[model samples]
Target: MNELLSTEEKRAVIELLYQLADDDFIISYRGSEWLGLAPHIEEDVAFSSISQDTMGHAAMYYQLLEELGEKDRDYLSHARKSNERKNAVLLELVNGEGHYLHEPRYDWAFTVVRHYYYSQAKKVKIESLKQSSYPPLAAAAVKISMELHYHLMHWTVWFTQLLNAGGEAKKRMLKAIAKVEAEFEDVLSLGPLSKEIVKAQLIEEESRLLLSFHANINAVFNDLSIPYKGEFTSLSGRGRFGEHTEDLSEALNTLGEVYHSDPGAVW
Candidate 1:
């Protein structure tokens, strides 16, 4: 696989890999913060499993980058600064405001909406990647897609149930959905390298993936008698362009605490 890739092709592949890895890594860290704070004991355990799977997916993408001659997976995941990261800004935002532990006011509605929207986008991207011209990426996409079914199901159930619950739950869910939609375009974008990524046949075009994502989500919304306005915006700076918020920096510090303490230590 290494021998087959030209310099330009390799660069594009590496860029896409970083975007994938960083997105998963940051979101999974956010998920981890919710570990024991989930609505119930059963959900706490379930959410942890999902978070672990997400981080595992990030590790897989990081390994692929390592194979392409990038920095070691640990360094890529831990040592990079927030501005050097490629995760979507939406993934990096704080759950609410206060710390996940202690008198926190984390938004369950936001979590449900964000997770549902993200999982849908991820499924669309993974489906397109399964047919990627890069055999290694296609293979990795196939592996990632296997776990995404459960991830999608879990979030979809929560999304619909919460919205259908009515009263404050429904209102909060709608508000959260609006917030998520405001910056969702960044999640659909392949960054500034979108042209090259698509030209190199690394993945499907952004428009195609976005269309599929909208269709998938709208179907769910329709089922629940919710309005399905296929509108998306990216008011936040693009993450693929290495633009991020302080949230990412704070998350990185927390997530990399142990690694920073002993970079040479073997787990």
Candidate 2:
């Protein structure tokens, strides 16, 4: 059985949980938008599975929050405003300019790069969380880690193949890498509560997490003979602090359409 957490520790834990849950929820929503619009039918199915897995992870985090006396999972997910969300801006950005239902100009290279980078970061974070001082969280980390191997392999294959194919594919992949790198710090960061979370022994320090993430990605680039300087910047505002773009506003409106209609209704 898990021990009761101190007030400060509980706050830190809740913050971290929100960050994990929101990030996965937003990204999975974006992935779901690509359901029937993927480049090919076979890939469409595989990608759907990944999206489902990601959303499942988000649900797990939200459930944890519910156990801690937060609102129910569905309300926490659908009722929260964009500014209230803790997801990184990278995940909230639209797949492209056009709507997902019509003429959706989704970028395959961006999808591959973003997924590969986020997956690596998540793996590092989960590994650290396996040693979390909170027993329930550490247990949850172990369960989540079981599913990550497949997620990592799936994205890594796409990342490597596209980078190796050369021609337009390679060019687009490189461009995507640059774009993702520019805004990836937000994804890797644990935000303003990082010090508290680390102090509570909930996870490792941000510096250590970044080191592991960079090392893993660097190894992949080296194997593929691609030049990687390994710089990550958060050009967009920090989502952890409740700052977000219009993209998140639009996403929340669309995703919450049903829930907002009747929040009190049991599903």
Report the Cα RMSD per candidate. 1.0, 1.1
Q: How many pairs of residues collide in model 2?
A: 0
List where candidate 1 sits over 4 angstroms from the true fold.
none
lDDT of each: 0.91, 0.91
Q: In model 2, which residue pairs have backbone atoms overlapping below 3 Å?
A: none
Question: Mind giving the per-residue lDDT tens digits that candidate 2 earns over 169-246?
Answer: 999999999999888889978888888988999999989999999899999999999998888888887888888999
**For candidate 1, lDDT tens digit of each residue in 110-144?**
98888889999999999999999899889989999
| Model 2 ranges off by over 4 Å | 1-3
Full-model lDDT, candidate 2: 0.91
